[model samples]
Target: MSLVSLILALLVEQARPLPYRRVVFEPLSRLADTLDGMFNAGERGQGVLAWVLGVGGLVLAAGGVFAALSALNPLLAVAWNVLVLYLTMGFRQFSHYYTDIQLALRMDDLPRARQLLAEWRGRPSDGLSSSDVARLSIEAALVGSHRHVFGVLLWFVLLPGPCGAVLYRAAAVFAEHWSRRSEDPAFGDFGGFAKQAFAVIDWLPLRATAAAFAVVGDFEDAVYCWRTQAAQWPDDGLGIVLASGAGALGVRLGMPVVEGGEVADRAELGTGDEADVDFMQSAVGLVWRAIVLWLLLLLLLGLASLVGG
Candidate 1:
């Protein structure tokens, strides 16, 4: 049932991607804000409670619905799973931006490419070279693929029903919303809690995605970078995926960039030549291949189960 639902969801997503701004996510965002407003008292305990209420409540509700649907009719439950996965998974949500950036770069339109990158990332792209644009676009694509596809799929397969996917996506959204450094008093003290919770949730999936990159790309280089360079990045999850992907593509990443008069120097990852417009296509291919690998594994497992039965 899990394999079937996942396959169907992937196919449907490819056929018609969901809207970028989903109505389903809006309520989750509002719920996070409500939790922050009501229970965020600038205390550690309060922040923890709010995180639990905001994330756990949603997951529980999703699981309850799946359970009820299963009791009424198994097919209805599968349909619900497909709907949830459609909302949660798929690369098209972010890949469109990636494609636009790639096309702009291919046409020697550096300014347009940088503008697109800035718009997609919500950061300034002033003074970024063509290489900078390529590297950052690749990095963004790799990380986005993990959050939107690999992480969600791992959790969905691990836990029964849609609970795993819901939990992972909810944790990611909450972490992104509340974990930023800020000086607003109403923001409360949940940033640390949100960050730590997401780290715990993402720990296994991050490494798994990295391993997949190694298998599907340059195996030895990917593993070497995964071990040696991942720690250089401040965020552990980002470090793992970026390092692995850079090595896989054999492209240098993490050069210094001047954004808003501030120079942010990132740790270098991967080997060989620096990224260019061509590597953008390589990154996209890498993600699609990873998805194929995942689907193949699931197909094998389903076949094995049938044989055993």
Candidate 2:
């Protein structure tokens, strides 16, 4: 049922992508803000309480619905899973930006590519060269794939019903909203728990994503980069994904780049040719292969369980 739900959801999403911001993000962002306004007191405990109320509350509701549907009819539970997965996981959520940027670059339209990249990442791409645009787009695509697809799929498989999917997505959104406000005087330690809690939740799934990339890509190079370069980046989890992805693609990433009229220093990851439009296309292939690998594994697991039963 899990495998079936996943496949159906992916197909449905490919056929008709959701308006993600309107459907999921806006409501969730409002909820996070409401929780912060109501519960935030610039204390760790308050942060924890808000996180529980936001993320845990959503997870409980999803699980409860799934349980009720499952008790009434298993098909209803499967439909619910498909609907949740449609809302939560899909390449179309981020791939349109990537596709447009790739097409812009292919046409030698650097300015358009830069604008697309900036809009997608919410960061300035003012001074980036073609190579820089390709590098950043590939990097963003890799991380986005992990976060939006692989991470959600892993959690959905780990927990019953759609609870894991809700858990991963809610935690990620809360972390983004709450964790980065540490420098705000009014926020103080209220975001501390969100950061720490997401770190714990993301650990295993991050590695699993890296490992899948390794298996599907240049295995030796991916493993080598994962060992030697992953820790070099400031965010270790992101580094793991980027290093492994760069290695698999045999493209260089994470070097210093000019952004906003300044040189933004960055650690180098992978050991191969400089990133280009070719490598960006390669990245799409890599992500698809990884997804295929995951589906195969799920299919095998389902077959084994049937045999045992």
Candidate 3:
């Protein structure tokens, strides 16, 4: 059931991608803001409570629906699972931007590439070079693939019904809304728990993603970068992913970039040549290979369970 649901969701997503921001992100963002407004008191406890209510409530609701559907009809439950997975996880959620940026760079249209990348990142990209554009796009692609697809799939497989899928996505949304505001006094400890909570939730999945990238790409350099260079980046979890992916692709990433007329110093990852259009294509292939590896594992697991039964 899990295997079939995931495959169908992927196919449907490829055929017709959802308008993610309008459909999924906006509603979830509103929910997170509402929860924070009602529950936040600039305290860690309040933040924890808000996160629980926001994230846990969604998880419970998804699980309840799945349970009810299963009781009524097994096919209904599968359909429900497919619906939730479609909303929560898919490559198309981020791939269009990546593809457009790749095309822009391929045509030597630096401005268009920067525009696409800026839109994708939701930030200014006025000063980035061609290499900078390619590098950042690859990084975003790697992380987005994990967050949108691999993490959701892993959790969905680990838990009953679609509960885990909802849990992972909801938790991630809350973290994005609250966690990054830790420095603001008004949002103080209200975001601390969210940051930590996501860290805890993402710990295993992060490493699992890194390992899969390594297995599907260059094994030795990926492992080496993961072990030696991952810690140097500001966000340790993302560092692990970028490091491993860069190493796997044998391309350098994360160096000083000219942003807002100032150089943003960043620790470099990977051990080989600098990132370019070619490596950007390589990154896409690496991500697809990782996805295939994950599906193969799920297929094997389903087969094993059937044989055991």
Candidate 4:
């Protein structure tokens, strides 16, 4: 079932890629916001209530959707999976910005490149060097790939199959979203709660991605970097990705990205980051290699299942 659903979903997704994304998350996001508002009535226990309100809501929602679709028709269930997969798994979510910045760099346009980075991160970019910009862009792309792609795949494999993909995606979104809300006088506790829950959600998959990078990129260096640096990163997943990607490309990737005032998405580049031509090439290679490795692993699991059956 996993193999067939993956194959079918990929075929359909490839055939008709979304032109531009619409707000598929509005309903869920609104639901989360509403519950959080009511339960997060106090500052002290607010974090606890927000987690119960946000994650608890998603678990119920995804399960309900799966149950309803399974009852309606198996094909309908697959369709539901496709909808979630379409939103969850794609590089376009973050890569288009990279492409624009890369184009700017190719023309030797430093300021423009910085602007792109700043806009992405919602920060100003007056101090970035050309190399800094390039390095930061590579790091952001590498991490975004893990969060938006590989992480979702891992979660689905472990849980309620493709529906788990949706759950994983929701978990990621809320984590990033509400965690940032920690700064908000309004939703601060909700954000903090989201942060904790998502940290738990991302713990294993982040390591798995780092391990994948080590195996496919430079086995010794990637592992060495992960062990040495991953422990130091505030977020385990982000640290593992940066360390492994730095080793994979044989470049420095652990430079601190400037944090914007808000709980801005640290998983991406802010403005003023540049991309090295060589590092970009290597980053592309690392991603494709990782993809091949993941597919092979999936294929192996499928084969093992067939043998057992």
Global lDDT of each candidate: 0.87, 0.93, 0.91, 0.70
Candidate 2's C-alpha runs over 4 A off are none
List the lowest-lDDT window of 10 residues for candidate 4.
264-273
Q: Please report the candidate that would top lDDT against the real structure.
A: 2
- Displacement of residue 56 (Cα, Å) in model 3 is 0.8
Ranked by TM-score, top first: 2, 3, 1, 4
Q: Tell me each candidate's TM-score.
A: 0.95, 0.98, 0.97, 0.83
Top-scoring candidate (TM-score): 2
Which regions of candidate 4 deviate over 4 angstroms? 7-29, 43-50, 71-73, 184-191, 256-275
Clashing pairs in 2: none
State the local distance difference test value for candidate 2: 0.93
Please identify model 3 stretches exceeding 4 Å from their true place: none
What TM-score does candidate 2 get on C-alpha atoms? 0.98
lDDT of 3 by residue, 209-247 (tens): 999999999999999999999999987479999999999
Model 4 over residues 1-309: C-alpha lDDT tens digits? 555566555566556654323543565566567767677764647756666656666667776887788898987877767676776676664576788888888889999989998887566666676776777788778887897678887887787746567667777766655665666676545466566677888889888888888788877777777777676666645888888877766777645544343222333212122348567767878887887788788899989988999
Pairs in steric clash, model 3: none
TM-score: which is higher, 1 or 4?
1
lDDT of 2 at 42: 88
